[model samples]
Target: MPWTVMPTFESYAQAREAFSWDLPDEFNPAVDFLRKHEDTSRTALRYETPDGGLETYSFDDLDDRSDRLAAALADFGVDAGDRVGVVVPQKPQNPITHLANWKLGAVSVPLTVLFGRDALQYRLADSEATAVVVDPDVRETVEEIRGECPALEHVIELGTTDAVSGEAHAFEDLLESYEPGIDVYDATPETPTAIMYTSGSTGPPKGVRHSHALWLGRAAAAYNYFDRGLEPGETTVWTPADWAWGAALGGTLFAAWHHGCTVVGWPRDGFDPEDAYDLMARHDVTKAFMPPTALRMLTAVDDPEAQYDLSLETFASAGEPLTSEVVDWVEETFADVAINEFYGQTELNLVVGNSSWYETRPGSMGKPLPGYEVRVLDPETREPLGRGEIGELAVTSDDRRVFFDEYWKLPEKTANKRTEDGWFLTGDLVERDDDGYLWFHSRTDDVILTSGYRVGPMEVEEAILHHSDAEQAGVVGVPDETRGEAIKAYVQPATDDYDPDTLREEIRDLVRDRLAEYEYPQHVAFVDELPTTTTGKIQRRSLRERE
Candidate 1:
């Protein structure tokens, strides 16, 4: 049964009336759910690894481990407002560390293992992290740079064995040695909950601090979007764990946990459609959230999709605009289970989303989620643009619900992003239709100008996705002598049987027929897969660098 379709929510209006405004007095984003349901021994987390090893944790298990971890961190001299860095994969230890940091009223800095010494050093120094919790394998990177990170007080390893002797504390050992208690400090809505770093194309990452109120408001927005259908003790699985560690850790895990949902994580290393299907099926997941890349891979798999029975009620994708083909395949295969696409960055949480109750449009990103005020402003003048005009998408600063506090240690950058009238400049160019649906354009810098035509890559990519053989396509601008700039598409073929050269020619012909003459890609390259960040976004900068 679909969790959302069930009477878990009495009605759409009821769910909205209950969660649409602010949270009730009894509800707390942290501690309340765990403390109240400590005895609800239902499986809060059901995880399986690449090796097929399974681990299950009940609500009691999560609460106990988190409390013990909190005590251990407190013992290590961790205190309120201190920043602690966590570098781990999709495992039980990830949330345990988050809860531990939250217990001491400290900010959790989520880092991925893929980040080498320079990225890690920069983040540690930038956030001025007091300590670090990382997987044992990645401890070597931290150990080598310990001399430079003077603020790093200790290192906590989260693997089977420690890579650094005496210097690192085994995560499991700390939990095993301690006992559960309710000694966690009380954090107010204004308390700084996290410092999430954005993946910047030009410079080092920018740290964005989010308060407890922002997180709480985000949870309410997610709950409202899902029609409050996510019940207590239900399993939700999302991949690329530490990649969007801040979003997944802060928004998904913490948000769901607050609503009494079990967050399931796994090692989403390579793109294996079969493995993804197997994991979803085996886990009996109720809610699944992923990026556009994962959805494309899942849709490209061979048919007879009924073999893998997915219990997903809410299938949500973020990070990038989703393709219509991917959304259609999911709904068709899953008996029309709603596929919600949300738009937001590390700086802000879910400001716009396609909720269950609302009707979904093919290429639109739905409306601004409740409690958030969205505006499309002229990039140059910073004045609001009328509907149907393409402009920068921004959130109102006065709302305070979905806005970020500031970029930690980067005041100048923060000031530049926020306007004098208190609107956050998203830097993303978007178009809003009369019906309030928001359509995505290319990133501000990625907008292409060819032969006096302003072309957005998404529009061209949508045309390419219609081709049967084309699994995924990324359109970028390459220098052109005559037209100033021309579209270059890098495509990943869905099947192994086709000839690359023939398909490339066919795609060009298809785009020429489907799109404007100047908008068609003059250069096409067939590859195994488009280069992507850990979060499954095609690193357009990397593709442009290839030219």
Candidate 2:
């Protein structure tokens, strides 16, 4: 067997019918990967630094390093079910730490490096993490908040740098001192593997605990949605999303490695279109996934096709709704490449997406993936809505492929997301057509009501982005005396020379011509940049608060 898509079927319907999820009594993702593939020489991870440095690791190497790190963690009194926070970048050490945790049956808590001191402290304190593995660059910040976190006991530092005082252990020293032989823990499918925090755009971040079976659930997204059935050592997958986010960790790293494909990891120093384009060409990347913000930046690049010899065959976008303009730009730029858009959350990995096997309708989020079912329901009535009616998106709770165990410790919050009839409310508003394609409307809170008319900001934002001069747009409702709320848009200009007054009027006219009278933005303000999360999702709540 050459690591191709297993259980191959003739058609998508056949594949969906044949798809079976059977997990062993004791399963670990890392162990399962090594067991399935006998050839240890295959490349598992391929990493590149910001300044052109490259490194490749084999499965054998990862197994050995993860074993050593697991032994060291055991020596440090880290037992099964203990929370170990990881705050490293998208390097070899990040995945290594995660694998080590899985081997020990401990929960791995991923902390983004971009977090400030307060956000970092909140997570550490909230999770009650007993140990943390961090890079040398973030050591000082960790130390500053160390005293505030009462549960954190040990600080394990990676990279070669000056060690801090107070019980800090060197990562390399542990690997050298400990024997690299330990039995893999008998972790069942329900065992906690990782706790990923939400971006907290609305409020404080909530930790979402996922079971060990999450890696197995990701197969549909990888094999079906991504259409990556590459042979061993043939496919190169790349994503700029940090390892902390579920998109990069589960979508790119684990999904690619599960299929024995090489995954590319790079540092997240702001988005640079030229550098990103060059990396894909240099590495011959065949599949890539990016956030909508990054895609917008790449579209803004002058002569993108002439800049680099892009080897990308398939590209996908997530994190937010992909604007119609960006979708058209991708088709025009990558003439032959297939562009698919996916939808998922921190709790659910890939619930809905357009696959290469299906026809992609721009601005539509596609249908439910195999093993998952989605529906649109009225918020107040909790009744399923008909086709073409906008309502809150909900997933059937019985679908094991796309459900989380719980919201870490918040029982009330977890209970609130589920309906009495066993459907998980996604908090996102969307509509399904008669053809079964899902279309994004807005977040329940992001929807605007002006003069007794309901509006979705995405519709107005899409119309504004249709203009040649507008790079990015954020639409929200501001206060009004006559109308309950008025539409206001924050526009980021594509060029610096354009007059703000003229551009604003142009955007307003475009919306008026395209949409209804109440949907047009009454106030337009030009800004250099909009607020975003670490994962590049626009902060609409923050935008509304500024008004």
Candidate 3:
């Protein structure tokens, strides 16, 4: 296999100075699998079925199936530049559909199976997706929205649930009917490849579209973030996060496949700590793209190492900032693993993060990744800010490969994400230190102004989580006459046994002492559960709506 963006530098400084994105004029994500069409024996995916059975797919297998599926899609009238939605979990069909879409020069729109009718309809209609590949379980959901989505012509069933062939085309039969080994499309770096939707935490979900170069842009950062392709062993990768999320798809699965490594997938309803531990041990997973929330949930397992034998080497985390407590626990839990915490968004990802080349300062987003010039900019002036100055984090286009193409036809929304001089605004508040480390404060909108002080919800939530009883915390700014906006915390206690009134006081005191007195939440409401995305990130906007 021809490896892309191999790391040769010994230190982060050398890498920062030496690295540059070198991509070919013609690029497609499928071609990143350099060893494809040759090796059928080498495993590409290892998926665990619902009945506790394991299914494996090799590179040759994927190539053939994807070729057939691509031919079938062509017969369905899916052409170049068309959008094909893949709305399934971590199944083999998920990867197959994506590969087929790219091979035909069509754009793949990945939608999580966790979305409801309105959520699914909005994306399908917004993208005007012509065809979609869905598991039988969610075929009914898609069928229900067919009337609203006039552009959708074909619904292809991917899995078994006895869905009649009358409603949707049987994916397996279509694949069998088509012939394999069709010619792969030669696409330019600017060829539209994917349109990924944001989590819609703040507003309606917007489609962050990208070119084929997105893979090349993300490949280098993924290499560094995952410890230079997790060398020195038979690297088996896994992540509990949904495959639709950027972190898991781009960072974990595609990165692994590009490097000819094995990726394991287990489709489950929710994150079960016990089941997660068992799966990791059984598969001997050496690398993971674990979200911070998943790491927090795994902490509840008492002596996990004793109960399960794990061979994890690199545990990469993102989606949310890592708190000191979780970082400390990760260090103590995994003796040999490198905990690399990175930073990125749906629009621009893997731009800044930590790798194995340097010492990671706790709670700080590491220096800029290769080919990206991330900076702190004055929100209003659009001017670069000095080190340690809090401002909006922006990606100055040192290379467009590390950025999205557009907001998928939403010209006005796309315009708002960029400054006139051309810096892509992330709308996140952060600070870069003199040492070249970036620290996240909060979203520009999530920053709470209370009693003449600027308070970030993350710092407050981190302190609240420090309390032994705090299982989860979502902080927001609520309306207040006295203070411009009061800091209100929605807390999920660790257990049902704790006294709510007493624990609330303790939480308030913990933040008051750990941080400034002004940072503590004036209003603490204990709830059984907090609203979260499928990836386990707390939806602060949902909490805001509760006000």
Pick out the ten consecutive residues of candidate 1 with the lowest summed lDDT.
1-10
Name model 3 segments beyond 4 Å from true. 1-5, 34-40, 160-165, 199-203, 231-233, 446-547
The sequence of per-residue lDDT tens digits that candidate 2 reaches over residues 296-366 is 77776777667788777788767667767777888887767777888887787778888776778999998
lDDT of 3 by residue, 4-33 (tens): 536578877787788766667667777665
Instruction: Report the Cα lDDT for residue 197, model 1.
Output: 71
TM-score of each: 0.77, 0.80, 0.81
Tell me the lDDT of candidate 2. Answer: 0.78
| Residue pairs of candidate 1 with colliding backbone atoms | none
How many Å off is the CA of 142 in candidate 2? Answer: 0.8
Instruction: List the candidate 1 regions with Cα displacement exceeding 4 Å.
Output: 1-29, 159-166, 224-227, 234-237, 240-244, 397-402, 446-547
2 or 3: which has the higher TM-score?
Answer: 3
Residues 237-271 of candidate 1 have per-residue lDDT tens digits of: 45543433544665566667666677777865555
How many clashes in each structure? 0, 0, 0
Model 3 local distance difference test score = 0.81
When superposed on Cα atoms, how far off is each prediction in RMSD?
10.9, 10.4, 10.0
